[model samples]
Target: MLNQTPLWKYIMVLMVVAVCTLYASPNLYGEDYAVQISAAKDSTVDLNLVDRVNAQLEKAGIETKAVALENEQILIRLNDDSSQRLAREALESALGRDYIVAMNLAPDTPEWLDNLGGTPMKLGLDLRGGVHFLMEVDMQSVMTKSLKDMEGDFKTSLREERIRYRRVSIVNDVVQIQFRDQETLEKAEFFLKNRNADITIVEQGELTLVASMSETKLAEIRDYAVKQNITIMRNRVNQLGVAEPLIQRQGADRIVVQLPGIQDTARAKEILNATATLEFRMVDLDHDVRDAVNGRVPPGSELINDQQGVPQLLKQDIMLEGSHIIDANSGVDEYGMPKVSISLDSAGGSKMSLGTKGNIGKPMATVFIEYQATNEKNADGKIIFVPEREVVSVATIRAQLGSRFEITGLDSPKEARDLALLLRAGALIAPITIVEERTVGPSLGQENIDLGMQAIIWGFVLVLAFMLVYYKAFGVVANVALTANLVMIVGVMSMIPGATLTLPGMAGIVLTVGMAVDANVLIFERIREELRDSRSPQQAIHHGYDSAFSTILDANITTFIAALILFAVGTGPIKGFSITLMIGIVTSMFTAIILTRTIVNGVWGGKRLEKLWI
Candidate 1:
């Protein structure tokens, strides 16, 4: 009974193996090349749309394995990539912008397993082939905008508070209010300190109060720009029907976006960099547009060109910004004119209500702003981008607009839908320039998968052969555990939501194949040493396993710690490697010690033996 494993222990090990094997089974089913079609905001998606897609695909002479509408999206599964591309192109043209036609790799997981929350491990860009983008957030733009907004708010607040100031301007990213005297400056500084908790009174002179955003506030703004960009990119990716995208903050001012299975780099860029924002400002009826456009611009109004390049004067004060918009939908009005209905959050509603109440009969313009990156670099070696601002629409303020409003000057339904998509997806707080772009085709991804799989297979087979030839019966137990070790590794990887199977991750698995048997080697050698000292086979087996546990635990603990550090500090591929290695170390320890010991117990435990083979 020296080496007997309890019934409960056997049950636990069997249960673990059974579950891991079950979860690992889905990866064998592979994937289906498919096109996913989702409706735009206020657009309808139904069986009729599925029929339309099918007809279009058929018209293009592309055969689809199945065309179905599920979860408010139409999915067309094709036999191969050729048909997939053909079907996507045909459907996109037919469906138009009302539907988001995106290329996807729909998993061929069975209903039962899928319903049980079993999914194959997500593949990374290197393994699945897609686009990788390194985007840099414009932190300067963020701080500048923050300062401008604060200046606007301060000027308005001081006026409302009956505090007079000669000038309020932003100098060196600090808002300076120049008062008539020191008494008024002190009054303003005291009022500001009480009003806003995020501003610091840097220096107060005789007639000027210099205030800037506190370090914490500036940090929060920087974080907001980066994190908000990540969030919006995720929304755009979801809208584009991308599956398992990796969008994360890289550093203080950078982001890493990896879209797996996305072949269209242009589409990827469009989705990530589409920071179209809207600004509502009153058309300056008091200013002369001709004079402003020619040589003498007005004091508080700017000369802007409409979408048709017609000159117009507009107030510089923004009544509302698109950042406050919560939702937008494109629909036809009663007259059948295309329009976009907008919904604003509570703050925006209040601001719009206040800003438009006095301008009832005046016209307000919707200025569309799009940032474009240029090859020209700034003095700081950063790329410079131009914001092409155009007055898209001018509408009369019929009444005081609040949370709900409509803009009806859209030329077509497509334009209205495009505007709605931009609004609904949320605007990036600041513009992001693409510092780097890389595309990995599906063919290359498949090549990586093949090569990585070959590495793992070969390494695993060699380890299996070595154990079998050297330790015989004990080797047989380890080989079985090793197989289960692999199964459990895949299973655990699949179970973890964030785990991605990259090419480097496969290398981690291969490294683990050899390391998985080290504990077995220690135990078998220990048994051989004990047997040479004239111990019985059962005694050798018992002492061998019991004595090796501490060494195995110590060795594996150190490796796991190193892997943890790597995961903590690494990014992208390094993270993939570290995570997989960490998971492997854990699973290997279980398979090598617990699983192999249970097998050895069942096979040869408590039996009388004159000699030991291990």
Candidate 2:
């Protein structure tokens, strides 16, 4: 009597449960491993870099159960404690030597039941408890790049015109000039205008003309950088594989990324605070800085520091910049000097060829190696560097002439390797640092789960009590179907690959509980109307379900459409809400219509029964 639902309806419920069980089962079957990374204050994690790290973990004989990159943090699940430690060691080595921030192991997690990718459902940050971070884009880096690009253009223009100018540089967002009187400045401005149309010349005085990059150009550059940052951020996230990571632009120069389920605070810091911009400059050994300070360096070149820390008066002309260096890697020289192997594009290759060819046998130090360092400064704000002996030579560059070059200046054994890893990975151009950090332990997650379960239980009780009070026996039947419907929804979700359960998703489920019984309520009400209109109970039952079917279809169709649209447009929790709601609707329709109809037919078959109260 209790199992009066139609055979088809029974089959549907059983099939759903079976499929869910299958999906919720883990594939590995042996052990669960996990690692955590937390972004610290004043640091921003690179989601892409984190992925490379996880890959390294896998290479070290450990497999990842889950990798969740959270807001200002990262968390990973592995096979077991030993595996986790191995993974953590690999991660720490990578982060400490390659990236530019401080990270720690945080605290050890107690033995969790090996549920890596299991169906008990891991809660996201908002649902469970974890660190949340809001990161701002590096506008300073953007501005610096813009200035450098403009300066590069200025140099090119001067060289093309063959006009000898005293000095041309960017200072405070405006191009300044110290030319041979006002005539040379005017001529240089005119030449630059042809090369760059967006510069506006405003006369500061007779001897100087303040040239500003056009407002339109500036706006265009800003917009482009913001969009570029979004793509870069997205790539990083995809690499990290943070379940349902949220990355979007907050404003023109700020981005907001939320990584749920992260628990290590310090490790998160290392991933975010790196500015992986690599550059190559030849040492200007043709002149001495003493001459410049004493006003006798040279007419065409400026004095600059070389790889040996000695000042050389080299030509001011940039043979090849970092942008031309397509790739860089860390490697060892024949004599064991740490060096970064650099690769150049066609243009860079030609320039490097010409520059290195003429200066062969003569001294040429690689200039501007600041981009290679991990941490730029010490605690006291002084710059940090690996000693001179560790620095690589131009011969290091020559070995990989056409291919990618390795910067062997990496002092620590692992440093060169990690640097090579980052460069080959096409690391981020802009510097991003986490301005904040925190961690959420699994215990806190368990507490949230308890509370969420309590809420769900309370909600069901209230819904059941109300239904029974109002509709009596009909309400009881509908309530049973409702309960079955909820089970089906959960079961179905567990079966879908990307379907995750979150707090908002729980809200969707609760809302669906109310919706699941609508068809039953409508059918029962129709049956009562038919009975009152002089129809027998048997006739009432048949007509009620038959008539309600059309209405049920129309109502569910609209709600289903809305859920689909929500799924299409929404992100993160919103998408989770839509998915759960959609699945519930489908399950509710099956239970309420076919199950209720079958039960009613079984109860009052071929008889005009009275007294419907239970």
Question: After superposition on all CA atoms, what RMSD does each candidate show versus the true structure?
Answer: 6.7, 10.0
Question: Candidate 2 — which residues are off by over 4 angstroms?
Answer: 1-21, 24-33, 36-122, 157-167, 176-211, 215-242, 278-429, 438-444, 461-481, 491-500, 531-546, 549-583, 586-614
Mark the regions of model 1 whose C-alpha exceeds 4 Å error after superposition.
159-183, 193-220, 250-252, 276-426
- Cα lDDT tens digits, model 1, 360-466, are 98899888887777879888888787887888678888888999998776788877876777677676788888889888888899999999999999888999999
* Model 2 Cα lDDT, one tens digit per residue, 67-184: 6565445766665557665666677776664332222222222234223334434346666455555555555556767777666656555655677776667878887656677777
For each candidate, the alpha-carbon lDDT, in order, equals 0.85, 0.61
Q: Worst ten-residue run, lDDT, model 2?
A: 101-110
Error of 2 at 273 (Å): 1.7
Q: Estimate each model's TM-score.
A: 0.77, 0.58
Q: How many collisions per candidate?
A: 0, 42
